[model samples]
Target: MCGFIGFLSNTNINSENKNNLTNMSSIINHRGPDECGEYIDDNIILCFRRLSIIALDSGKQPFSYDNNNYKLIFNGEIYNYIELREQIIKDKNITFSTDAEGEVILAYYKHYGKSFVSKLRGMFSFVIWDKINNKIIGARDPFGIKPFYYSESSRGLYFGSELKSFTKNKEIYKKEINSKSLHDYLTFQFVPEHNTMFENIKLLKPGHILEKKINQKTKFEAYWTCKFDPILKPQAEKIKDIKKALEESVKLHMRSDVPVGCFLSGGIDSTIITALSAKINPNIKTFTIGFKDEGYSEIELAKKTAENLGVENINITISPEEYMEAVPKVIWHLDGPVADPSVIPIYYICKEARKHVTVMLSGEGSDELFGGYNIYREPNSLKLFKHLPTPLCKILKYISTIFPEGMKGKSFLERGTTPIEKRYLGNAKIFKDHEKKPYLKSYNKNYTYDLVTKPLYDKCKNYNDVTKMQYIDINTWLKGDILVKSDRMSMANSLELRVPFLDKEVFKVASTLTLDEKINEKTTKYLLRESFKDILPEDTVSRKKLGYPVPIRKWLKKEMYDWALNIIKNSKADEYINKEKVIELLNKHKNGKIDYSRKLWVLITFIIWYEKFIEEV
Candidate 1:
């Protein structure tokens, strides 16, 4: 596990570019503080920072063969390397140079060619240079567990594990903000994966590969697509399969040369992981963080859950000031604006866990994979809208506006009357189009969220409404938001975080579960809860998602109201947003006339991100 940077250029690799490459790699040194390596040539340069997880003695990266005929730079762990290498030795009569995973990747690619990625089962973002073919190829994992960003310039193609790496060479890489992305960011609170907030640099989509040669257009294609063809089966059969798959996944994810532990939140996601992990390795350690008894903190629950599972639990309580102090650095580590307040404690927990362990197991993808979000139940609550005619639905939407704000079914009447895409853009809905009109100077009706979600919705046309929501989120909310912050926060602490819930085999079992199994009248993650009911605490099976709930709304009203007002008053946001309007909203919240805390937080984060990335201040 590490961070890497490389560029393929038509011009010579001069001393200036070499210096920039080294600086870029060093800035992300926290990602892999153990060791470093480099490979420089006339037309290309590959720099790597090593964290030394799997084969600590011989895992130095930029792994090459045939005297540099094929060089590699990778940023994630390949869990199936042992199996792949054994097969290559049997079928291709090839002998590996070391026990490290890179050689297995090289050998498998040599035999399978471009299709090699589809055969692997792990979280990875790897780039290989085929010197003989005069081509360089890069691929991100199926679930985007690792990150890959690149910029196309006249010089050539530059890529790296973090956006800051590309920013190191500003002579070639530009840092202008993408306004449409900012507009979308206000609604979603994070930029979409395919489009970064920066104009030139973009995230390579998960499950896809980009291949390019000198004087050739980059050819990009998806090596795999996670499909949901829910198979109807007995409840008992589905529960058994899910149980078997999760246990197997946890076993595979424990493949590490270093000590491994787990992060335990109050939510069942992490509780389930800790239970399964303790069964396999009873000595495993777990970590948690929370606040005082503010009705939202989860530390007490995490403690009880940890004791029930019989693992050493480390719990930390963060004061409001400590949480406030960590914001700037957290945003810096994040590489972009992510308004998810939960990241603060997540970052701190990873930092604390790093002192005791090198690798930590996390429960990130379970919610998205199993339809665990409470918002997913909207379709069931709004079933009446499906029976209404389209014209009548539109008329009802107009009439619903006349209803008071707290009136029953006001939101239901408004959302139920509209199409899914128009109403739902994943779980977040911060600012509506008309609301954003007061903020931005211009809006592109054509380039609205449909540019992102329509394609995904069209692909899953035959799925049930709940399944369709899960599909959209698995691609957008899961990849763009959840995994992005998860990677950045964990890596920021120089700790390797693995998600067994995101394993390919686990996803297969989850995909086979019908909507009823995922969410029913009583609870979310119904099948998952049933599968672990015998193992986990009975109350845990029905617990709501109380993981890391920071009191942002209260903070804005009391603790940070003055600080927030000054930020807006002093911000360059006036160029894009109406300061008077923003001030009005902030005042309304402070005076208890409204609850625009989320919108305010999103705006403040954007300002902070813009200043850090674009303004160079």
Candidate 2:
């Protein structure tokens, strides 16, 4: 619901540092244009920008508690604050001065110490400065629905909700690209771990707590882990539990003081969210976006669902030119490169929804949480690997290399022979290990995507293939890509986007679903469909997942060919990227020799980001 930036310094604060803090906070004003608050002490500064979701008049932050001994600057919603407040008042006999959620957080921290985070639920990233103990405690939400970035410099530690905020105070921090992260970005289209595109700055992993005291080493630890534990239960009973949990989550998520709306799409995830939300509030508004290109737009399907639910549907059809124009701004808001074409539609939809509603509910975590991706079905198709001997599969993999690239069944053979740990790298696989050698000038043969995935895969070794993939995504893809775009795009428009599907209660239900309940031979999210069949339209229950189908592949070939080529020719990333090779790929796509849209887009976004953050700065 907001954005925050601050620093914990090793020395006393000065006027220069105060000015820098103001500038740093000013840069992210779009995140919270409603109000601004600041708290400064000898060694720490906390600046907050409010979006005014719940406690409109009384929620101004840098909330001081315990006789002004503790200071808290928070950047998310505590959906259960009302319940927590009641418990605190009864147990400690406390009198609150305001209805702000930040007060509830401070009281809980006083009572529970470091363990307070586990007792709460909702998406959040916050920092609390204990003036009494000269200590700092920071934590990100369980699913990373919000962002928290920090850097440890000689001056001190600087933290913020967006990476761009650090750029405003160059005196305290230096801007240098992290080469290892860039190398990984080429393969995964994102920095898969805690390390970010910048060298010193790092993203705090989800469900993790960071503690730092003055004149001591900073420590980080995980307070929660997303592990799946399926229980043996009847299908009908499980379905009933799922419906109840999701309904409760949605109802809680709609606890905004302002008008709340839902993002609708042709897919079932958004439809189900809208359907459930409409039942709670009959006059809810839904937003959708699509393209003019055939087989890409879902406007009609979304409209049909909205009509069926008796809600007003506001929609737009983006032209290729409009989509191209928004690319640079989208990349800037993202704070780094994310090659997901779906981000464009999300950006536009958030902009549109903000016009009517201050808070929007999205369906981002459903795919990762409930095994909704089509690739999850790959394990079932590759069952032959389990039947055949390892040596024979290796031989088949070798034989597959003899066939030409893109030959029928070639990728299947290659993947079937390879281990799941090596073959699967979350949802987006832009450049493979061998493919990056030609495109990256600083490519290290030893550095590969495995550096990020191997440890995660090792943790889930006991899981089935389908469950392993889900675990990997819930750890990497869900946080790195899906939530990044959702947070940045929504905040860029000053809109508070909430995910009912990513709630703690809903995740507990999803973790217990069997593979048969999640995916069958014919469809994904099987249990979800079965649970909501009577409420949703039949086509919606059975519709395949086509999440924001962007026609970037077609645009790169025709409409945006010259625009993309211009960026490739003039890009200043030659020290890191091989421009000639990228141009060749772009030429091949335009000439219809290959469909290199996804790969080309990855390079284009990074180039634009480089220009914005590196060259322009």
Candidate 3:
């Protein structure tokens, strides 16, 4: 809902420096174009840009508590702030002023200290400046709904809601790419937590807080963790509990002063959200994006769902050309390369929805929590790997290497033969290890596919195969890729997106369901569909899942090939990547020799990001 930038120094600051902080906040002015404010003390300077979501008239940023001893700047929504405030006042016997969520946050922090995060039940990333303790306390939300990046420079420690804010300081070094993060981006499409694509800058892990003491060391620790406790409860009992919990979460998430809307896709997740929302408010408006391509068009399904729910629906259809043109603007707004092609249309959708409402509800966390992805079906299909003779699997892998290029089923043979650790990097594995090695000028082993997957594999030692993949996704894929796109793209339009599926109460029930229930009968999200069977249309509850399907693959083969080639050929990305190799890959794809849609898109996005942010020109 807002953008904040602050710096904590070990020495006294002057007016000139204060002006610099003001300018830094201005760079991210788009995030909070409604209002702006700044607060500075001897060793800390806090600045805020307000978007005016809940308390438009009186809710300003840099809110202070305890006679200005506790000052803070925030970027996100606190849906349960009212509930939290009532509990704090009653439990701690605290007096408060202003109905602003910002004030409630300060009071809660004062009463609970670091433990305050446990009581919070919303998306947020904020920094609290403790004038008395001469320290700064910061925390990101539990599911990483909002982003927070910080860097230590000669000026001191600088923190901001977006990366561009920290880069606003001219003296601070910029354009120093973090190779590890870049490699991760190339592999996973988004940089995971604790690693940004820039050295000396890091994303605050979700559910974690940092405390930096003046003239001393800074400490970061997690305040919460999402632990899976799969239950073997009956299907009927699970469905009953799930529906009850999800409905309550949706009800709680609807608590806002402004009108709320829902993002409706043809899929079950969005359909269920829309169906539930319509039950509470029949006039609820739903937004959907339609593409010209038949396979990718979900607007018709969304329209059907809306008609069934009897809610007003808005469908925005865009041509491939329009989506391509919107890419650069979206990348600039995102502030980093989140190479999800779906981000483009999602950004446009939010931009369109913002015209009607300030706050919109979405179905984001359902996939991660309820085993929604078709890839979750992979462990079931690939369970044979666990029973395969190790030597035979290795021999099959060796045989796959001898298979000629362009041969059908070769990649399948390779993927089946190789260990899951090496083959299934994440949900979307664009480039094979062999293919990527030829592209990187200097392959950094430290950031290879194993770097991201090994830690996950180790953590899932005792978990079932399905649970292992789910746990790995929660740690890597969900926060690193999906949520990043959702949060950044939606916020870039200054629209507050609330995810009921991500609500802690909903997660509590979903996380407790057994893998068999989640992946029952070889189908993904079976439990979820069963829970909402009565509310959703019978056809919708059983429809094949088509996830945010972009026509990028088909476009790259035909219409967009020329544009993609031009970008990759002329991009300044040559400094880091092998230009000839990139062109070779594109040429092969264009000539119909290979399917390089995923890799070409990744290369094109990286080039676009470099041209916009890294290259000075």
Candidate 4:
């Protein structure tokens, strides 16, 4: 519910250097407009902008603990602070504190070191300055629900809730594309962990902690991770445990002192959240975003779901024109390039919700936890198709390329015949390996798809088919694409977005279930629905997961085609990308030779971001 920026230096500087930190924090003022505070000590400068969600009057930062030996600036809600505080008081004899999560975090760190992150349950990205050790310890939430970006420069180590905060540092030059991150961003919609467009800047991996030793080395370590732990419990026991855990998550997520709302998307995930939320408090307010197009709008469905649950539903309708208009502003808030078109609607929805509430609950991590995406259903088909001889498949892939681009079934044949290592580049595969070869400044065939999927693949080496897919998503799609967009979109509007589905307790319970319960040849999220079969309406339980459908494809073909073509043509990215090749792709897309919506959007987003953050430099 707040945004904070902090710095640790090897030496002190003048007013001009101090103003850099001030400017960095000011850019994200919308994230915490209620209050602003700064802390400038011997070798550190900590700044905070507070949104005042919980302990409004008392929760201020940079809050110090152990009599100012350790100071902290945190940007998130610690749902279990009340429990943590009580445990600390009883077990550790800690005393004298307001009921704020920030204070508990400081005390916990004072006692636990980096181990404290594993004990907390909430969405957070925080920095604690240990004056005693002269070190900065940082941690991000387990599910990547919160964002933390850091860059090391001659000035010092600067960290913030968003990348824009580091823009004011004169020493931090806008370096060229980090190729590894570029590959991931093109293959997926967003860049994966430890990779940012700028060479030195990086995203803190989820479930990981970074320890920067004074005037020396910085080390990153993973403190927690979710694993598929299949239990032998009976169905009845599973249902009871699921209900209990989910109810607890919903209740904890609503621990704010101010008004909170839920994003009801007319899907099983949102319905489950709304159903549980209303059961706790029927006055729970919910918001849903719908489009003018019937193909994308889920307003009616969300309204019915809300009505059935006896919760108030506030629906916001966005027109195509309006959605396009919000693109630049949304892109700016995103900080880096992210091509998820839904971010536009999310921005408007959060903007509207902020008018009524300071915090909003969203169903973000459900798909990754449970098997919800349609792609998970393709493994069997892919496995069968993988039987073809490599040489024969390569021949077929080459021939398929000659078939008119975007022709029906061409993509399937191309993907099916190609090897998984070469064809399946995470979920949002935009450009082909060959297509990127000519575009990248320096293409490295040495870099393979294993770069991103290897970690999860190795982790799930002993797991079942479904569990492998789940693990793959958790490491790639979940953190790289979904959580990145979720955090950026919500924070863009200065609204605190909490994902009840991502609660560690809920993850612990869900991860224990086998693949058979989660998904089979018939359907996905079966076990999840059955657990709440009695609570959710019949229609809700049986409904298929229709993703937040955006009209980007339709817009690219008509309304936005000219604007997009112009961007592609004029992009200074020609220095990195092939201008002629890009123009050809645009023309083919305009001529209906290719259904290049996703690819075009990714390219345009990257170009715009590059121009804004890199080219002008």
Candidate 5:
């Protein structure tokens, strides 16, 4: 709904700092073009841009409370604000001046202190300057649906909704590539944990809160974490609970003053969201995007789903040329490299949806929360290994190495023998440790994917393999890749994208699902499909998850071959990457020797991002 940038310092405010803040705000103006506001003082400055979702005229922020003693700048929607507002009025006996959620947040903070964040139920990243206490309190939503980035330097601490906002004020924060993040990005297709591609700047982990007293070091604490506690209940009862939770979440998420729409796909997740939304507003519109490529496009299926729900479907088919042309702009908006090919379609879809509506509901967190990924079925497929002795499995793993590359059953043996902690690294595994040594000029052997996953694995050691995998994704994949593209792509067009599936209420129901309920021998998200079987079309409910498929593999083989080769040739990343190795992979792909699309895409995305932020800057 909005974007904000600001800083806290011990030095007095100057005209140059004010100018820097203005420039920072201008860079992200697309996030909120409706209005802008600022709050400045001797040691702190807050600048905000508004899209005016809930309160239209009343929600202009830098909303203050308690005789202007506490000032707040927020970037997201508090779907439960109306309910929280009533609670605050009754508890504190305070009269509110505006309908803005930010004011309610301030009043809540005044009454309950930092503990107030726990009571909030929405996607948000906010900073509250407690002028009275002379300290600042900042928190990111539990699921990280909204972004918050910060850096510490001699000039002080700077924080904002996007990484680019900090680039404008170079004197306050210098830009340099973080080698560790780059190395890990090669493996995960995203920079994991708190570190970003840029040095000093770090993403505030979801469910975490930050507190900083003037001139004191910032302190962080986890306010919440995603953990699964499966309750053994009857299948019918669990299905009913899931249905109730999702409907309630959809209802809460639909609260907005502006028109709201839903993103539709042939897949069950989006189709379910659109189906539920259409029931609430019969005139609801749905948006979909696909490619001209034969197998890559889901337009027809989405159209059928939309027609079944009796809603108008707005769809677009992107060409190779259109996708190629949008690459630079997409990477720029992402603020860093995210090699997920799906980002392209999301960008185009958000651009198309913004033409008709200011707010759109999406189904992003469903896969992670409800175990919708195909890979979640891996443990079931590899059940044979569970029956084998550990020593025998080790022997099989050794024998697997003897088989040639691309040999049938070679990967199966290797994966079955390995422990889940070592084998599974969320959904995207672009490069292996040894593979990176050949591609990365400055590869650190210690900078393996385990550096990111091990700590997460340790936390959920008691969980089942399926739950552990979900936990890893809920922390790494969901926040790093999925939610990053969701926030950046939607904000790129000034459209407010809400994810009802990621709601705390919906997650509570998902967390209680048993492994058999989430996945079985035949399908994933078993309970989810069962709950919506009657409401959705049969094919829509039973369809396998294709995700937002892009024709990157096919495109790399033909239309975009030369374009990709040219980027590799002219890239300024030679100091960090092995150009010859990357070129070899590209050439091999073009010759149809192998499908290196994902690896090439990861490298190409980093190159484009490097040129934009490093060279151009």
Candidate 6:
């Protein structure tokens, strides 16, 4: 609902530097366009852009608490602020103030110190200047629904809701690209958490707090995580629990000062959200996007569902030129590369939805919570493969690798025989371990995606195979691509996007579902579908989750091939990429020898991103 930028430094606050803090606010104006506020003092300066969702007159930031001893600048909603404020007033004798949500953060932190973050129930990223302690403390939400970026330099520590804010600092802007992240990007399709494209900048991990004392090293510590300890219950009982949880979550998420809409994709996740939301508020507006490619479009399905629910549906068709032009603009808002092609459609959908509503409810995190991805079913078939002797399986893996590329059953043999940690990275596997070698100027096997996923796996070691894969995705893919894209794209249009499925209450129920409840031998999210089978359209409850599909594969082979070739032809990424080898991959796809659409999409996105940030800047 807002964006904030803050600077902590021993450097004197000069007039020019103060002007730059205002400039930083201008750069992220799209995130919050209603009002602007700035706070400056001896050793620190803070800036804020407000969207004015709640307490329009009283909710302005950089607010000082305890009579100027502590100042706060926060970006997000604290849904339980009323409850927190009442508790603080009753138990701690803290009294009377504006009804702003972020005030609870200051009140709680005053009494509980770092542990105060554990008591929050909303999406947030906040910075508080503890002037008395001569340090700063910041925290992100439990599931990373909000974003926080920070960098340390000789000037000071610069932190903001976006990475583009760092561009205001000369030193932070001059750092070299993080090649390790580039290689990992090609593999996982997004820069993983903790690291960004710039070597010096990093994301504040979800459910963690960062503490910076005057001249001491900064430290980060986690406060929450997803756990999969199934409470083996009857299928009927689990289904009822999921229904009650989702209903409660959807009701809580509907708390908004402005009119809220839903992005209906015709998939179970969005369909479920739309159905539940319509039941509460019948006049809710719904939006959907479709491509020219009929195979990839779901406008008809979404419209049909909208008709059944008797809610007004607004649908738009994305033209090729509009999609092409929005690519660079979308990358600009993303702050870093997210190679997921679906970001394109999300950008358009949010842009259109912003025209009619200020807030929208979306469907994300349901897949990771309850088994939703089709790939999670792989472990079911691989169970027998895991029963084979290790020596024979290793021999079979070697033999399978020798078969020609695209051979049937080759990928199955390789994945089934190998361990989950080695085989499953996330929902996507763009450039294989071998495929990445010839394409990058620098490659390190140590820079593998496992560096990002393995720790998550270790945390969920007690989980079943399907749950382990879900954990990896909830940590990596969901945070990096799904949530990031959803947040950035929606904020780019100055519209707040809320996820009913990602609520902590919903996750609590989902975490307790057994694998059999999450998935069966044939379908994913079986329990979730059956829980609302009667309410959802008969077609939607049984439909596959294709997401908001973008036909980049077909476009690259047809209409956009020349456009993509030209980008690779006159390239500036030679220092980071092997030009000839990338061209070979592009040529093979053009000649129909291989389906290199995803591989080329990864390259094209990164190249455009590199040009916009590295070259154009």
Global fold similarity of model 1 (TM-score): 0.97
Q: Tell me the TM-score of each prediction against the true structure.
A: 0.97, 0.99, 0.96, 0.94, 0.99, 0.97
Clashing residue pairs, backbone N/CA/C < 3 A, model 3: none
Candidate 2 lDDT by residue in tens digits, 463-488:
99999999989888888899999999
Which stretches of model 2 miss by more than 4 angstroms? Answer: none
Q: By TM-score, how accurate is candidate 3?
A: 0.96
Clash pairs of candidate 6?
none
Per-residue lDDT, model 5, residue 216, is 85
Cα lDDT, model 3, residue 501: 92
Q: Candidate 1: where is the Cα deviation over 4 Å?
A: 388-392, 404-408, 443-446
Candidate 5 per-residue lDDT, tens place, 127-189, comes to: 999998787999999999999999877667788999989889878556568889998999999
Model 3 Cα lDDT, one tens digit per residue, 360-429: 9988888889988787786666677667889887887888889898788677768676655656666767
lDDT of 1 at 402: 93
Candidate 4 pairs with clashing backbones: none
By summed lDDT, the worst window of 10 consecutive residues in model 2 runs over 169-178
Where is model 3 poorest over a 10-residue stretch in terms of lDDT?
Answer: 417-426
lDDT of 5: 0.91
Name the lDDT value of residue 512 in candidate 4.
85
* Least well predicted 10-residue stretch by lDDT in candidate 4: 418-427
Write the number of the candidate with greater lDDT, choosing between 4 and 5: 5
Shift in Å, residue 99, candidate 2? 1.2
Using lDDT as the measure, which candidate wins? 5
Off by over 4 Å in 4: 382-423, 438-444, 615-617
Give the true-structure RMSD of model 3. Answer: 1.8
For 1-617, candidate 6 gives per-residue lDDT tens digits of 89998878767678877877777778999988998888887778889988878777788888778888888888888776777889999998877678877677887888899898888877889999898998899999988999999888777788899988777766568647887889889989999888999889989999999998776678899898778778878888888889998897888778877889999988999999999999999999999999988798999999999998889999999977788889889998898888888898999999999999998999999999989999998888889886788899989899888979888888888888898888889998898766888888888777777777777888888877899899989888988889899999999999999998887778889988888888888789989999999999898888988898888877877778788888887889888877788778788887875688899888888888888787777
